[model samples]
Target chain A: MKKTELLFLKEDVDIPYNWAAGRYGSLFLTRLRDEGKFIGNRCPSCGKVYLPPRVVCGPCFTPPEEIVELGDTGTLVSYSVVNYPFIDPETGSRRPIPYTLGYIRLDGCDTYLSHFVDETDPAKLTPGLRVKAVFRPREERTGRLQDVLHFKIVD
Target chain B: MATKVAVVGIGMTENKSRWDLSLPGLYRLAYQRALEDCGLKSEDIDAVAFGHSPEYFEGVNHPEKWCGEAVGALNKPLFRVHTGGTVGGSVAIAAYYLVASGKFEVVLAISGNKLNETSSAQIGLSTVYDPIMGRQFAAGAPSAVAVQASKYYSQYGYNEDHGLMVAVKNRNNALKNPYAQLRIPDYTLEGARNTPMLCHPLRLADMCPTSDAACAMIFAAEHRVEAITDNPAWVLSAVAVNEGINYVDRDWSKPIGLRKAAELAYERAGIKDPRRELDVVEVYDAFSVQELIWYEGLKLCDWGEGGRLMESGATRMEGDIPVNPSGGTLCANSIGASAMFRKAEAALQVMGRAGEHQIPGVRRALGHGWGGGIQFHTIMIFGKDKP
Candidate 1:
C-alpha cells in the first residue's frame, strides 16, 4: 500500500531575545517611526552615508558623526520577484507569492536598502527605476524598518 | 640579549570603518607601507607576527590564517598573539623576541581590529564578562570603566573635569595628527564638560571612538638595520605584566600590573627616571580617566598625583615631556591596533619620523598598553641611541 501523505508535527519556536539595537540602531528605529523619514549616518573617514545606520563604517573602520536627513525617493539597484511559496516567519502563514524584492539606494545614502516593491511585473520592475517608500499610517506605525510598507514605482 | 633588535619600519592605516577595503586588503596596505618605509622586499622578511582583538568583535576567528600572507607570512613561520587591547603591543614584543632570540633576522608584526563587522562591539564585549555573574548586567566595557573612574576620582580627590581636560587636549592634538580619527577642531574642556554623560563619571566626550584600523612594524637584527634605515628606533626594553582581579580588595586606581611592568621596563632600559629620561610617552588611554591613572602607573607621577601632573601642564604638547603627541587612543582607538599605536608613536618620535605631531629633540620614548579587565599591561621603551 502506498502512503497518501507524510506525518509531521508543527509548532512555533519559543526563543525570545530582548535584543538591544544599540545606540545607532535605537536612533534609526525611533526616528523612522516618529518622523516617517529616513536619517543617514555619514562615516567621517571615507564620506559614506550608510543605510540602516551603524556605529562604524565597514570600509574605513571609523565612527560616523554626521546625521543627514534623506529623501523618500530612491533608485532600484537590483531586484527579484518571488514566485515560490514559503511560510512567513512573522505571521506563521504562507506569504503572498509574486512579490517584488528590490535593493534600493535612497537619494542621500551610499548604501542600499533591501525592501519590498509594489511592482510585480519583471518588465515594469526595471533597474535604475525611481521608487518612493510608502509608509504605514501614523497611528499604526511601529519603530521598525517595516514602518515603511513598501516601495512604489515612480515615473 | 642574544641578538639586538631595532624597529626599522612602521606603518599605520588611518583609524576608521575602512569600508573601502577588505580585511586582507587592510592588512596588505599596512604591510606594504612598512616595506616601503624601509625599502624592504617580501623576501627580506623571515617571519611574521599577527595580533587582533577578540574574534567576537569581527565574528571571524583565526583571522591570522588568511591575513598571514597579507603581512608577508607565506612560506614563513607565523606567530599570532591575542591579549585583548594589548594585542598590538604584545605582537611587537613577540617580533622583538623572534629577532632577539637569533631565530629570525627580520620579522614583521601586524595588529588591528575591524569592530564594524559586528553591529555593536559592546555586544561582543558583553560576552567578555564572567558569564555566571557579570553577564547578567552586561553593560560591557563602559560600565566597568565607569566604576574605575568613580574609584579613581574618589581616591585621588579629582573630579570629571580632569578627564575633560585630557579629552580636550587629546582632540586638539589630533588636529595636528593627520592619521587621527576624531580630530575635533577647537575642542575645549568647557564643550566636553557640557556633553551628556553616558555613564556616571563618564561623558560621551571622554570615551575612545572605535575604528577598524591596523598597524605594522618591521623589526630587524642590529646587523640588518643599516640596510633598512639610517636611523633605527632601537628597542631598549619591553615588558608585559598582568594583574589578578579580586572582589574583596579590588582597587582599579592603583594598577599593580602597570607599575610592575613600568618598573621592569625602566630597569631593563637602564633608566634612572622616566620623567626626565623619556622625551616622549604614549599611554593607552581607552577612556579619559585611564590616561590620568596610567600616568601614575607609568611612574610619571606619584599615586593620586596624576591630576596634579595634568594640572601642571607636564604632559601637554609643549610641556616638560609630551604624552600622546600622536593624539593617542583617545583620538583614534582601533582596538587591536590601539595599544600598538602607543609603541609605534613612541618609536616614530624617537626616530624623528613623527610628522605633524613630532616632538622636538626626543632621545628616549615610552609606550604603554593595558587591557583585559585592566589586568594586562605592556610597556616598551625606545631610544635614539642603541642601549
Candidate 2:
C-alpha cells in the first residue's frame, strides 16, 4: 500500500486604479469638500446649467464657461421609500432597510441630482417637498458625492 | 455602384498615459484637431461615428452617449461601433460608407480608448475567451498570442528570431513618429532578442504598451473633397470579415477571415500582386508575431513562408513594399484607436502628409486591422489617384 499527499499552490494579484474627475468635475467636488458649497456650471452658448459639471453641454455642443454658486435647498421631484433589505453593491454587505432615495431639482440648476434622503416614511415624502443638503464635516469630507451625507426635508 | 470618397483629414493624439483629461475631454482634443486640420467647423460634419475598447477597460458603459458632444455630435446624428482591436477600422469603414452611399457628404469617425484608465487591460482582454470552455486558459492577450506564435513557428520550423527582427525594425521606425510612446533610440535586433521573455516566444519588447490616445479621420465625398483639401487619399476599396468562434476547423496560425477580407479588397481595387504593386502598408501589429502572421494573411507572402519573407527584408523600409512606415501599432497602441491609425497612416502616405515617417514614392497603400481572437478582420486600400 502507498500513501499520497495532495498539495495546493495559491497566489494573489493586486490591481490598483486611478480615475480622473476631469476639469469641471474637480471644480464642483472641490467646492463641496473645501467649503460645503453647491455649484453648477453654465453653458456658454445655450445658458444651460449642469450640476456635477461636465466639460460640455450636449444639446449646444459647446464648453461650459461659468461656475455659479447654487443654493443648498431644492424641490424633491420624486422619491422612493425602500422597505426591504438588500445588499449594498459598494460595500458588499446587507444594507439597513427603510432608506429613502430622491431626485431633487436644486435651485438655479436646470438638471436634477439624485441623493439619499433622511426621511424613510412614504407618508411624509411628497413631490415638491423642499429639501436641503446636509454635508459631512470638513475633517471627514472627501471630494465625492458622499461629502454631502444626505438631504433633509426642510419644508 | 457607390460614389467615390476620400480621406480629407486625420487627427491622432500622442500615445501615453493621460491622467489629466477625462475620457470625453480626451475625445474632444482629437475631434478639435481633425476639425482644424480640414478647416471645417462642427457644423460641417454631417454625422459622427465613434468607437473605443471594451467598457470593462474604463468602466464607462455607453461611451458614445458620454462623448457625443465631445466630438461635435450634439444635434447631429452619432453612433458607436466596436470590434475589439479593430474598432477604429470598423468606424473608418462606417464613415466611408456613410459618405460613399451619398447619405452624408462629410462624415467624422473617431475611435480610441483610455486604456491606462484600468489597472490591468489584460484583465479585460482575458474576458474575451469563452467562459465555460476556455476561461481557465485565459491569462491575457500576450499569453494567447504567444501560443499563436509558437504554433505558427512550429509549423514552419522557424524560431523566435523573426518576431524579434520585427520588434527591432518597428522600434527603430518609431523614432520617426512624434506620436509614438515607446520610441527606443537606435533600437537594434540584439537589443530585442536580449530582452526578458514573458511568454515562450514573446518578450517584454515584443508587445505594445497600454496608452490613453484617440484618433479621428474625416471622410468626404468626391464632390466635396476638393473644398476640404487639395490632397486627399482616395478610397480604393474597403472590406470587413468575421468568422464565428465555434472553432469547428479554426486555426489561429491561418487567419481565414483576414485572407478573405484581403482577397476581396484586392479584387475590388484591381491589385493583382500586392507585394510589388502597393507602395506601403500599415497593418495592426499589436504583437511582433502578428506582423509576420498578418503578412501571410494579407497575401504579402504565402503561408509557411512568412518567416522566409522576414529573412528576405522585403517588408523593410528600403524594401519594395515598405510596411508600417508610421511604426504601426507596435510603437503606439490605444486598442480602439490603434487600428484606425493604420488606416490613417496609410492615407497620410498617399496624401504626402506622413511627415518624417512617410515612405518615398507611395502612390498606393493598404491598411489592415486584425482583432477579436483573430475572428474579425478589416482591409482598406488607399490610392493617390481617384479610381
Candidate 3:
C-alpha cells in the first residue's frame, strides 16, 4: 500500500437554540428558586409523583394535577465514578476529573433523579444508601437542579 | 391478509474510521454492492429509506440531498428516518412497510455514520438530552450506560468479570467477520479486564467503537422476490416500541421497551419460545453489558440470569443459539448502520450467505436494536421459509 497524503481543515460553526421551559417546568423551577423547595406533580390516574413536574403521565396518558412538595432526602439507586476528563457541552470547558455521578430516588417521588454525587470516591457510594440534596445558598439560587449542588451521604 | 416482504439482497462496507471516503462515496459503495448482489439495476429500486443518527456527527444537514444521487434514488420516494441510534432498524422497518403495503415492489434501505468527521462525538451526543435538565449532566454514552450497569449490578449478583466475558466473546467473534471494525484476533479475559476503565464498572474495551461504514439492503414483496432470488430471507414480523423519555419511569436494567417490542414481534411471528425456536439472534450490544441485558429483555433467559447465560457459553457462535456471529454493534458500530447491520446479518444467516459466520441450518433468526436512553426498541424476525 502506498502512503497517501491527507489534507484536513477545521472550522467553527455556531448553531443557536432557544427552548421553552413549558408550563410544568416553569412552575417547578419557580417554586425551587423562590421557596428553596422541590415540587413534583401527582398524576391524576396513577398518582405517581413526577419530579421536575411533567405535564402528563406517560404511561397513563392523563394530565397531572396539583404540584406537591417533595423531600430533599432519598436513596441511592445507582452511581458511577467517571475516570475520564472531557469537555462539558454546557460550559465548553473541562469538567473536574473523576467525578461521582448517581441516580437517586428522592423521597415522595417515584422516579430516580439523575445527578452528581458530592463524594468522588467509588467506595463510599452504594445502592440504597440514604442521601440528602444540598442546595446552594438562597441568594445564589438559579432555580435549576444545579441549585441543589449535589447529593451527599446522609444519616 | 397483508403483503409479505423478504430480503433479496444485502451489502456492507468495511467498518472503519475512514478519513479517505466522502460521505457520498460511502453510500455509493454500499448501494452498488446491493444492486450487484441481487442482479438488479438502480432503476429497479422504486423507493429508498435512509437511516442516520444526528446530522451533527458528520457536520451535514439534510444529507439525503447530498447523497441521494449516489444511491440512485434521486427522484424517487426517498424517505429519511432519524430515530436516534435506532434509525437503522427503523429504516429497514420503513422499507418493509413500503413493500408490504403493496404500494411498492422494491425498496432499498441505506444507512451509515462517520463519527470521525465530528470534532467530539461524545459531546455531540450529549446535546440529545434536554438543555435544561440533562445537557449539563450527561457526560456521553459510556457514563449514561454506566448508571444502568450499576443498577443491574446492584439488582443482580454479577461483577465486572461478567462484562469482561462479554467483551472477550464479542471481539473474538469479530475476528471471523471480515467487515467488522474491531477484531482482536488473540483476545482473552485478562486483556479485557486490564483495559482502562472509561467509567466505573465499564472499561474502554467494554464499549463500542465509533465506526464509519455504510450498509444497504434490498427488500421486495414476496411475489417480486421469487424472480430475484431463490434463497430469500422472509421478513416474518417487525415492530418498534417506545417508552417515555423521562428516566424516572424507566428501569434501564429491564429495558421494558425492548421486551414490549420483542413480545409484539414474537407474537406476530408465532414464536412460542425464542431460545428453542429461533436459530440465531443479533441484538444491540453497543456496550458489552447490554448484550446480557438484552438476553433477559428478549426472553432468551429468565430475568436476572443474563450473566449466567453468558457464562454458560450458550450464546457463542457454536452454541445452541448463536448470537451476534457477525460481531454485533460492539464490534463495528456505525451508529446509523449498526441496527441495520443486525438485520442484514440475520438475513444472511438464514440465507446461508454469511460465509465464515454462517450458522448451520438457520431456520429462524431475530435482529434487534435499542436506542434513545433505552427507550426506543426495534425488533424484526426473519425465517428461511415464508410465513
Candidate 4:
C-alpha cells in the first residue's frame, strides 16, 4: 500500500450556446423597457385585447389592427408562492426563495399579464388585489421585465 | 346521426433511441406497418389526422407540413392536432370523428415525436405555461407533476413509497414489451426509492424517458371495416373535451378536464362500471404519479384508492384490469406519439395483438390522454366485438 502511487487525468471541452441576440420577439421587450410604456395589440375582428402583443389574434385569426397604451395599475387574478430558489443568469448564482408570481390584469387591457410580485405572504396575494408596476431607475432600464423591477402593493 | 366507426389496423415502431431515423422516416415506419396491417395502401386512406406537440421541441414550425408527405397526406385532407402532451390520443379521436361523420370511408391517424432532435425537452416545455404566472416559476413538466403529487400527499396521507411502487411496477411491465425503449431487468422498490430526486417527490426513475417513436392506427366506417380486417377493434365511443386554461377558480390537485372527459366517454360507451367493463387501459403516464391519479379520475378505483390499486396488483399484467400493458409512456415516451400509443395499444389489446404484454380475454379497453396544464383531455373506448 505504501509503495502504490496515484495519477490524475483531466479533459477540457468548449460548450457553446449560440443564441441570436436580436431575433424574432427579442426586440419587442427592448422597446418597452427603453420607452417606459405599456403597449398592447388590438384585434380588429373580435375587438379582443392582447398584452405584450401577439402578431395574430387567437380567437379571430386576424392580425392586430392597432396598438394601445396600457396603465401600470392592475388586479392580481391569481398567484403562487415559489419556495424553490432559482439561479440568476446575470449573477450566476441562486436567488432567494419564496417569491410570489402572479397574473395581473393591466388597466384597459382585456387579457391579464403574468409577472413577479414583491409580497411574499400567500394570503395577501389573491384574486382582485390591486397592484402597480414598480419600474427600475431610468438609467438602469434594459428593455426587459427586470426594468420594471417587480410589482408592489398599490394600496 | 353519427355513423359507427372501428379501428381496422394498428402499428407502432419498436421504441428505441432511434438515432438513425429523421422525423419523417419515423412516421413512414409506422405508416407503412399500419397500411400492411390493414392490407391496404396509402390510396385507400380517405383522410389523415396528424398529431404532434409544439414545434419548439422539434425546432421546426408546422411539423405536420414537414412529415405530411411521408404519412401519405400529400394533397389529401390533413388536419393537425395539438394538445400539449396528449396530442397522440387526441389525434385518434379526431380520426374517429371523420369516419363517424360519414364524411370519409377510412381515415389514417398518425402521431410521433423526436425528442432526440432537441438538447433538452424540459427547457422547451417550460414555455408552455402562462408566460407571466407560471413561466418564470416553470420547473418543467416533472416539477409541475411534483407539485400536484405534493398536493396529493398533503391532502391524503400518502408517502413517497406509493409513487415508488408505481415506478417499479411500470418498469417491470416494460420488460415484456418489445417496443419499450427503457427495459429494466430487475427493479426493486428500494432501488426506486433511492433514485435521485429531480423535483421534490419525483425521482429520476419516476419520470418517463424521452424517445423517438411513432404510432399509427387506421379507422374505418362500419361498411369499410370488413374490407380491412375481420378482427377489427370496434370504436365504441370517442370524446375530446377541454377546460379553461386559466381557470383560477378550479382546484389544481384534481384536474377537472379528466373528470369531464371521463364522464362524457363513459356516457357514450354506456359504461356503468369502468373497472368491470373495461378489460385493458392505456393511460397517459408521462410521470409515474399521473398513472395513480388517473386511476381515480377514470373511476377504476375511488378517489385516494389509486395507491392501493397498484399495491394490490390490480393493474398488473395478470390482474383484474391491466393498465399500460405496452409499458405506457414511462417505458417509451415521444410526447406527441404518447397519446396515440395509448389509443393504438388499447386497440391492439381488443384485437388480441398485444404480443407478450397482451392481456388475456380483453374485450373492451379504455384509452386516455391529457395535456397543457391539464386543460385538454381526450378519451376513447374500443371493443373486440361490435357495440
| Best model per TM-score | 3
Compared with the true structure, what per-residue lDDT tens digits does model 1 show for residues B26-61? Answer: 889989999999999989999998999888777667
Best model number under lDDT? 3
Single out the weakest 10-residue window by summed lDDT for candidate 2 chain B: B130-139
The residue-level lDDT of candidate 3 at B70 comes to 91
Tens-place lDDT digits, model 4, residues A1-155: 56534332333222344433332134446656777777777788877767766667755678876877778888776555555445432233455665666667788777656677798775464456799988888899876656777788886
TM-score of chain A of 2: 0.85
Q: Which CAPRI tier for candidate 4? A: incorrect
In candidate 1, what are the lDDT values of residues A96-147, reduced to their tens digit? Answer: 7656656578887877666778976755755568999999998878787778
Which window of 10 residues has the lowest lDDT sum in candidate 2 chain A?
A83-92
Q: List candidate 4 segments past 4 Å from native.
A: A1-155
**Deviation (Å) of A85 in candidate 4:** 13
Which is the winner by TM-score between candidate 1 and candidate 4?
4
DockQ of each: 0.01, 0.01, 0.67, 0.08
Clashes of each: 15, 0, 0, 3
The DockQ leader among the candidates is 3
Going through the candidates in order, the fraction of native interface contacts each one reproduces equals 0.00, 0.00, 0.67, 0.05
- Models 1 onward score TM values of 0.72, 0.71, 0.97, 0.77
